[model samples]
Target chain A: MATKLLSRYPWATSPFVIGAPMRVMSGPALAVAVSRAGGLGFIGPGLKTTDTGVDLEEASSLIDKARASSFKTLSSSSLLPVGVGFQLWSDDLSTAMGTIEKYKPCAVWLFAPKEGQKDLDEWSRRIRAVSPETQIWIQIGSLGEAKSILQSSEKPDVVVVQGTESGGHGRMADGMGIMTLFPEVADTLASSHIPLLAAGGIADGRGVAAALCLGASGVVMGTRFLASSEARISRGYQNEVVRASDGATNTTRTLLYNHLRGTYGWPPEYSPRTIINKSFIEHRAGTPFEELKKRHDEAAKSGDSGWGPDGRLATYAGASIGLIHNVSDAERIVRDVRNDASRRIQGLAAA
Target chain B: MATKLLSRYPWATSPFVIGAPMRVMSGPALAVAVSRAGGLGFIGPGLKTTDTGVDLEEASSLIDKARASSFKTLSSSSLLPVGVGFQLWSDDLSTAMGTIEKYKPCAVWLFAPKEGQKDLDEWSRRIRAVSPETQIWIQIGSLGEAKSILQSSEKPDVVVVQGTESGGHGRMADGMGIMTLFPEVADTLASSHIPLLAAGGIADGRGVAAALCLGASGVVMGTRFLASSEARISRGYQNEVVRASDGATNTTRTLLYNHLRGTYGWPPEYSPRTIINKSFIEHRAGTPFEELKKRHDEAAKSGDSGWGPDGRLATYAGASIGLIHNVSDAERIVRDVRNDASRRIQGLAAA
Candidate 1:
C-alpha cells in the first residue's frame, strides 16, 4: 500500500526515513525505536562476504522479532516501514536473498558494487520477485550514476546521492559533493520522477533546509543519528562522534579496519572515513600486508575496544559530524532535522 | 581564430581566459586591460541598478579603442575575443541590441532575468544576426536554472552555474553552498555536450582539482583575483583577503557598499557574501531604504575613506579566502591554481 501510494504521488512526503544501514550499530531494536519515533528504520546486513561463519542469521532473527513487535503495534495502529542493506560488492547475494525471501524488508539499499558487475536488472528483479513493493534504493557517488539510474530499466524507487564526505566506501573518481549533486540530479531526473534523498554530511535541520533548496524532499543522516540511544554503538564510540570536528575526520580507502577485524577481500576503491589513530598512522604509508594481517588477527581475538587513538578500528563519520556535540535521544535528532529547517525557512521569509 | 577555437574547446589550455563581465567592476578598461594580459575580457552593461556614470558614448569609445588594440594584436598574432554582457532583467531588448551594435562585442553574457521574458527571442536573434560566430554564455544560480536554459531556444555555448558564495547577486533561497552546488551542476551537465566551469569559493588549484572531480572542466575564480595586483581593488583591501580566516567572512545580502556608493534598485531575492565588520554589525539586520539614503548622502559629501573593517563599505569574499597569504600578481594567481591542483591530485593519487 505504501508502494502504491508513493507511485501514485511522487511529490508526496514520507515520515518513513530508514536509518542509513550501518554495519554494527543499527539492528532490530533500532528499527523499532525509529518507527516508535514516527520514522522508519532498518537492520544492517553488514558485509555478507561469500566467506563462511559471518553469522548474518542473528541480524535476520532480530528482524523477525521486530516484525512481531511491528505486528503488535499495527494491531492497534498503522504498519511501519522497516528494511535492510548490503555492500553489493563484498556481500554474498544468494545467502542474502534467502533471508530476504523469509523475512521481507520494506527496502534494500546497496552501495559500492564491483565495477564490472553493476547487475541492477538481476538485483532489482530478484527483490521484486520476492516482493514487488519493496524499494531498491541504490546509493550513487557521482552524477553519472544518477543519470544512468534515471535511464536504466531497473529504475530505483529512490536515489541516494552520497558525497565524498560520506563515511563509508565512496567514489574517488568525480566524487561530487552532496550540495551540487542533489539539485542537479533533481533537475535532470525530473522526467523520471523518483523521490530524492540526500545522504552525506547532513547532521541538522539547516542541512535539511539546504538539501530541500538544492532539490531533495528529505535527508538521510548517519553519524548524527548514530549517537541516538537506540543505536548499538559503544558509549565511547558515540561520544567520539559528539566530540569530533569537521577537520578531525580523516578519509581513506585503506583496508585497515577490515584487516583489523580479519575481514579482508574487499574492493580497493572504497575507503572508510575514520580518525587518525596511532596504528593507522604507523601502518598507513605502508606496513607489510603480512605484518598487518598478523596484527589484525591478534586484535580481532582481543576485541576492538583495546584499540584507541593508537588502535586499529576505523571511526566512520560524515563532514557534518562537526555540527554534533551531544549524546541525545534519537527522537530529539529527528526533531532537530524538522525544527531547524522550519527556523531557517521562517527566518528567510521574515527577512 | 583563437575566439572561435576557444568556443569550440573552452577547456583547451590558453593564456587568455575571458574576464567575466561584472556590474560596477567591469568596464572598457577592465576588458582591454585583461586582454592586454593575454586574457579575453568583457564589459558589463550592468542592470539599470548599476549607475557608474557610463554613458553609451563612453562605452563605445572604450570598445573602439579595445577593438583597435585587439585587431593590432590579432593581425600580429591572433584575434582577441572581446565581449559585452547585459543584465537580462534590468534592461529592455532595444537597449541590449543597441549596445551590441554600438560596442560590437564578440559575445554577450546574460544574468538574473524574469522567467518567460519575450525579449529572449529578440536578443538571441540580434546576437546571431550581428555576429553570427559570436558565443552566448548564460550565468545561472542553480541546477534548476541550468535545466531551464536547456529548454530555452538560445542554448548557451557555455553555462556558468553561479553558486551562493559568488560576489554578486544570487538566490539566497536556503543558501545551498558551492561545495554542494558545483558537483551537482558539473555531474548533471557533463552529458550536455558542453564544457562546464566551477565558480564561487574557488581560490587555488585544490579547488580546481575538486571541481574536476565534481565533473567540471575548468574553474573561474573571482575573490582570489580581486586581491591580485592587476585588479582594481584598494591596496588595503587586497591585504584583508590575504590575512583573513574563514571565520572572518559571513554571507549577507545587505546593500551597504552599494548604498554608500549611491547605487540601488536591485531585486530582493539576490544576496552576496560579505566579510563581517563593526558598521556591518550595527546595520547587519538591514536599514530602511530612506534611512540608508540619508546615510549615503552624508558619506558621499564627507568623502570618507571606507577602507578598513570599521568603515561602512564591505569586503566580499568566499569561504576559501583563508587560503590566501599575499597580494601576488594576477599571473602568479593563475600559476598557483594550476600548481595547487596538480599537487593535490598527485598527493591523492600517490596516497
Candidate 2:
C-alpha cells in the first residue's frame, strides 16, 4: 500500500486524468492540446443533441490525430498517455472497440455502463482480447461505485472518481461534494491495488497540491479547461466563462436544459452544473421535465439560434468557473500546473 | 466611485459603530457571542504594545465557555447592529479587547494605507463622519500613522486599525505598529473626534461579526474571529489556534508568504494573505529569510527563533488569541458595535 501510494500511477506519468468522450467538446484539436498540457486527453463520439457534432466517423479522424501526436510526444518526453472515452450506456461496444483496436490508444475510458460492473468486466475482457496495449479507465460517483469496479473480475488500470463538483454529467446529491467525498474515496481506495484520479473543482496547481495531500496522485480538471482554445464550445460560451462572476456560478442538477433540448436519459443521481444562461432562463427554469422535452423537440427542429441568458444553449460549466478568467493555450496551463505542483511538493517535504 | 462604495459600507443603524474585540479566537464567549447576545463588545485591541489596553478601567469580564462556534454567517444576519474586530494591526488586540468588551458589538474593521491608494480621502472620511449621530470609527495600521485623519484633518468618532499581523507591533515600516501607535495617540486627541483602535488578522466571529464588523459601529480585525469554530482552516492548525497558534504573531512587508505558500496576489495586488501553516515547507526550500535578515540587522526578526515554516509557533495572530475557535455570542458582538458607535453619533446628532 505504501509503495504504490508513493509511486507514480503505473499507466500514466502523472495522476492528471483527462476527461474522455468529451462529446462535441473533445475534438482532436483539444485532445492534442490537453495531451501536450500534461493531462491525458480523450476523444469522444458526441451523442449530445445540443449541436450537430462528432460521431464514429469524426471519432476515427480524432483517433488518427491523437495517434500521430502520440508518437511525437511518446518519443519526445514522458507522455501523460492519451486515451479515448465512450459512454457505454449509450454506445455500442463494437464500434468503440474498433477505434481502440486500430489506434491502440493509451487508454479507453468507459462511463455510465448499462450492466454497471458487469459491463465494465465484459468490456475489459473484450478490449483486452482485441488490443492488448489499451488500458481501461472507469469513472465512478460513489465509494460504493468504486468498490463494485474494484471487485469486478477484470481490474481497470485507473479509477477516475467524479465528485459532485463535476461540471457536465455527474452525481448531484447534496451529501456528495468534493471537500468530503474526495478524501473518503481516496482513503477507501488506498488499500486497493488500483490508482485513483480525483476529478471536479480542481483549477489551479494549488488545488492539485491540496488533492495530492488528500491521497490522490493527481486530478482531472473539466471546467477549468473548457475555456481553453482547444475546446470546441463556441466563443460566446467560452467568453461567458472568462466573464463569469463568482456569484453567478452557483449550480444544481436539473433536467431543464436536457429536457428542453429533447436529450433525455441522464441517470437519476447525475445532473450537470451550469450557469443560468439565455437558453435555460427562457425555456427551462420552472418547466417540468415533460414540458422541457416538448420545448427541446421544438428547438431541435428550428436550427438552434442565439445565446442569451434565456436562450436554450447549454453552458456546461462547474463550480471552479470562478478561477478560469482567460482563454489560454492548454499546454501553458499544463506546464504551469506540473511545475507548481512539483514546487509545492518539494516545499511540503522540506517543511 | 468613492462615495458609492462608501455609501454601501454603512448599512448600520444610527451613527454608532461598535467594536467586537476578542481574545485568542472570536468564540461566542469573547466577541461575536457578546455582540450578538449582549451590548456592543468592542472586538479587540490586537498587538500587545497598544496602550488602549493598559488604561481601560471599563467593565472587564471574561467569557470562554462556548468554544468553537464562530463563523461568517454572523455578518450577513440582519440582527442587532453587531461588530467584531481589532486595532488595525495589533499583536495584542485580541486579548485586551476580549477582556474589556464583551457583548453585542457594532462595527469591527481595519484598513491600512496601501501602496497605491495612499489617501484616506473618501471612504474613511465618510464612515467616520456619517451625520452627527454616527460613531466615528478609525483604525490605524501604526500608532505613528493616522494618514487618513492626518490627511483630511477629520477624525472618526472611533479610530481603530492597528499593528500588522503581529503579536505586538504596528504596520508602519519601522518599529511603529497599531499597538505602539493606537493607544499613544488615542489619548492625544484634542476633540474626542474618534476613539483609536487596533487590528490586523483577528480570527474569530466574536472578533469578526462581533468586534470588528459591528464594533465602534466598527472595530478592526485581520486575523482574529476569522478562525471561529465554524470557519474552516486546515485541521492541523484549527485544533491549535487558541492554545497553540496564538501569542507570538509577527508581520512584515514582503511577498514572502504568498511566494512561499502558493497563492497569487495579483490584479488586486496587495499585501500577503497569511494563512498560519501554508508556507512551512516552502520556507525551508529557499534561502533562509532568518539568515538574510540577520545580515540586514543584528536581529529585526520575522523569523528569529521558534518561527519556522512548518510549526509556525508565532502566527500572524493579533493580541486576541484567547477568544478564537468558539461560537461566541453574536448578539453581544452586535450590541457593542451598535451601541458604541451610536453613543458617539447620538451625542453629536443631538447637539
DockQ of 1: 0.04
Interface RMSD of 2: 21.6
Query: How displaced is residue A303 in candidate 2, in Å?
Result: 8.1
lDDT of every predicted structure (CA atoms):
0.57, 0.48
Winning candidate number (lDDT):
1
Q: Compared with the true structure, what per-residue lDDT tens digits does model 1 show for residues A248-334?
A: 224344557666656665556566666555457768668876776676556545554534454455666665555677877776666
Which lDDT tens digits does candidate 2 get at residues B19-138?
Answer: 334333333233434333432444444334243343232212232222224433334432223333433322343453442243323343434333322333333344333332333344
Cα deviation in Å at residue B259, candidate 2? Answer: 48
Can you write out model 1's per-residue Cα lDDT over B111-212, one digit (the tens) per residue?
A: 666653244545676777766666676776665665565666766777766655456566554334455455445545656666666666556554555454
Quality class of the docking in candidate 2, CAPRI style: incorrect
For DockQ, the strongest prediction is 1
Tell me the spans in candidate 2 whose CA falls farther than 4 Å from its real position: A1-20, A48-72, A75-81, A247-250, A282-305, A308-310, A344-351, B1-351
TM-score of each: 0.50, 0.50
